[model samples]
Target: MMKKITIVASMSIVLLTTACKTKDLKMKEDRKEFISNKKEVVYQVFTRLFGNTNTTNKPWGTIEENGVGKFNDFTDLALKEIKDLGVTYIWYTGVPHHALIRDYSAIGISNDDPEVVKGRAGSPYAVKDYYNVNPDLAVDPANRLAEFEALIARTHQAGLKLIIDIVPNHIARKYEGMNNPNGVRDFGADDDVTVESKRDNNFYYIPNTQFEIPDTDAPLNGEKNPLVDGSFKEFPAKWTGNGSRRAKPDRNDWYETVKVNYGIRPDGSKDFPELPAHFDKKSAQEHFDFWKDKDVPDSWKKFRDIALYWTDKGVDGFRYDMAEMVPYEFWSYMNAAIKVKNPSAFLLAEVYNPDEYRNYIRLGKMDYLYDKVETYDKLKDVIRGHSLPDGLSDIQHRMVDIEHHMLHFLDNHDEQRLASPEFAGTPEKGKPLMVVSTTISTSPTMIYFGQEVGESAAENAGFGTHSRTSIFDYVGVPAHQRWMNNGKFDGGQLSESEKSLREFYKRLLNFSLNSTALMGAFQELQSVNRDSSWGYDPGIYAFCRWSTTEKLIVVTNFSWLTTSTFELKIPSSIIRKWNLVDGTYELTDQLYQESKLTLNVTHGEGRIHVVIAPSESFIYKL
Candidate 1:
């Protein structure tokens, strides 16, 4: 009897273990399913300004006076609040070490000459070290990289990925990689400075020209620095970051940086091998295989190693600055190598030329490119009342082939703030524009820090003035501070209007995150409704997005004073695609559930009447 009881108990334990294993496997599968289907929403935060509580508006203020935010400032509560905004990724801009006018000689970090730097903080694009984090952003300067790694771990723990910048086209005028690993030499260390261009040289020298500082009315902006004596020693000046082949670059040029040469000669001829014909259609792994044994430039190898090093340290991806300035072949080799280490690394680039979009995405292996020239420009005009909302349909039609590869943003560090007088003059105006930009296609949506709470960037911070946030100075973003609430990250100090706007953003963004239709097929409904009895006008833009199980109807009213009431028509083509029968279906607003609307389908046609206020948008579930 005892032996029979023991056998029965052993059988029960085995069955229970098997059941638990099956449940865990299913959970993993579900997580992967959600990751593959959800649309990505990226929150871009300027690393220095995100958590600064200093209210001092001193122009050209030093870090101690203005107070800089540290990596530890991104506390768990702070990251959780950001993740709760429906953000899939957090892009920490200015994480890499850059030239700044601070005396860090105690830590082996040489102070940058004010004559060669942009502002007190220096430009984030002017990278001084690729293998190290900005010392200014660390609580303990000696453990700067470790602090950044801890932040990376915290960000991932909050279920959000992290992205850092990689300025591969150039480096700080005085480059120094203090944290470079063994056997990895610094950029331009072995350069033959006597030649105009060499196949293996990291930089292109002007042969015999000496570097001359650009003439400026206010040298060092009146800052008294011994090094700002209108002299910076450089033998055989290299080309400027903006491809200016001059010994003394123009004041407006990227004079603080020296350009990296990727085997492209000064005469516009390729010194390296070009990608083979039809190579654009190959996968990243295939591209990786193709370049494994190919002879590439030293600059290319250095960048690839930098990227891989960051990846091994838990960096999820990189945002390539001025990507178009570099050769596409170099990107193919560099991005492919990154993919081999981490297949899902996010590779976003700033390629403004619309003509080179496909070549950059396909051959360059970039996952996303800025949709600035086409979509962002059109939307900017529409919001400024310079263009009708109807023009968005034409823009969307042109880029249908590569729509998903585009990333949309209403404001970035490079653009004016929505609440600034130079822009729309009110954060409310961004409602319709944000709705259109975020849900217009299957592209990723990006929101700059302080955008949600309406940061006007009104301070006249030395290097960069009003209209845009100053990336080149030690400063604080006021409206964003209200949201940060002294690192509570709970929007405790925000005004009612600011809170309401942030809530609107939260709802729309969360909807986009969970909705399958957002990442599915899209069709414009404006052209069909323009002729209908619905009184559809150019000020109104409407569209539809649907998948096998979910369908959405989105409409926006761009006029600031006009409240539009229209009978939006979903034509027979869309109705057939959606497979709707002749019945009345409830259409609920996903953004604000204030409107009671329904779609009436009759004989293969769908119609719904919507009343949208000025600067209002409706994302309806049909």
Candidate 2:
């Protein structure tokens, strides 16, 4: 009887040991997968604002300045500077050939105006040729590929990923060989009267339609329309004849950008009014359809080749500009092609809308989209003296809506800076605003150049380049000096408020990068009671993120002067003890064992950073 009992006991021990080994193996696999899925941070660079290699002849300076018309090489100095910023991805804006059309200037200016000529670096959105790199941005005339390769290599060596801008919607009006065959001229109204009148070009009349109405009612599609009334309705312009009148520059000139007609008919007989006269309507449709179907035209395939060319040279991804405007089918095909060439390649699309567009996530069109809704709405609330809402719930919904989709940024090239006095109350109030934006948001964040230094607006200037628009002050200085003086501008240096804001941002970024809680998925924690001040204010928000084995809590006080206090209900078995590393709060083991803890926070005192010690994050052992 004793021998039988011993045998049974031995069998049970062996079975338990085998189960333990299996669980360990599974955990290892899970860990590997989790690490692989970690998100990356991308920093955008306006190369022109970065520096000029030649001080005597600053290349790519305005044409009036007799600039050498080329960008500097990927200097080791520049790479080191960017590396110190603690970002994983570097997005180089406008690396391609600038628009060839020099005839018409942007709104609020004439073509011959000195400011117009000086500021005419050519809109990067208007692509002249996909194959050619802008000479101004190239380090060497002939070794463009080599220069690009070297840049990519250096970026990779510094533990950074490179993402170049890609404009897919429109090409330059005067591409060398691909000129507007339709005789459509930009400033043709001022040219020879007879010649301009005879041409049945689309550019002759700028549509003054309102966009308030749906696309179906708009005269020339909904693309070119003004906002009318409170709602977005489209009303035809007061112009008499089809090609008789020209609309004002800012209001309607952008309408001249023709829309592409995807082939819907089998015979391709549709006459797309947006097609340039030089292009055969049917042939253009066929061309567009070929690419849409993945049978890309050899000529058009150059765009894909450009992306692959850079990727093979070690670029990490492409920030596809105007991605939403392009046909969904094209991106679906493009993403597949990109993955085949480089699986690890990150594709970020500049999609502005929150609605699920045709190629959003289901088609695998892009890995990330510019999350405008979160930035403009949610982030706006916190800055406007409102409480930070239950962001975790919204984040959960967004995560479920688009799995593996990266959230883009609060500010980019097209928008004004959040730190600008226009948005964040004043320069004094900007620091707290910046903290909330960088830390509280769930998406992987992006930092525009000069943001870290808290560079505010210049006198009577907007946020980007023309006025306070510069990423850095690059006037009349050597490349090294300009590079070294990155965060400072010539006339507009960083203020005391700006310095503090910059340091705060740096710390927040480092903390986010280091914390698994901020980097990983978050779970919304339930409040103990709805009557509590924290729960009553829609702006006050709190959430907890936990790895399979570790847990973290994040709370934000969004009110201006109110103090918020709330109790946390944690599972006693999972959390043994937790400490707030921000060192503002004192939490004991009794609180954890009881599975309850009350948090008291002062409002508008900047984000009350609560950190847990002895962990990469403020962690509680489960």
- Residue-level lDDT tens digits of model 1 in 1-622: 1111111111132211111111100012222321357788999999988889998979888887888899999999999888888899999999999999888899889888888889989899999998898898999998899999999999999999999999989999999988899999988899998788998999989888899999865744796888877789888898999999999999988999999999988888998888899999898999999999989899999999999999999999999999999999999999999998999999999999999999999999999999999989888777775655665766677776677789999889999997788877799988888999999877899999999888899999888899999999999999999998987788999999999999989998899998888877777775566555444544678888887788999988777776777778887878887788999999888998877698999988988978878788899987
- lDDT scores of the candidates, listed in order: 0.85, 0.44
- Taking all chains together, each candidate's TM-score versus the true structure is 0.93, 0.62
TM-score, candidate 1, is 0.93
Per-residue CA lDDT of model 2 for 9-128, tens digit only, reads 111322111111111101122333324434356788676545543334333333335232234434666666666666778888777655421333322112221111112355566555
Report RMSD for candidate 1: 14.6
Off by over 4 Å in 2: 1-35, 52-74, 100-119, 138-146, 177-302, 385-388, 426-442, 459-483, 486-499, 525-530, 533-539, 560-622
Best by TM-score: 1
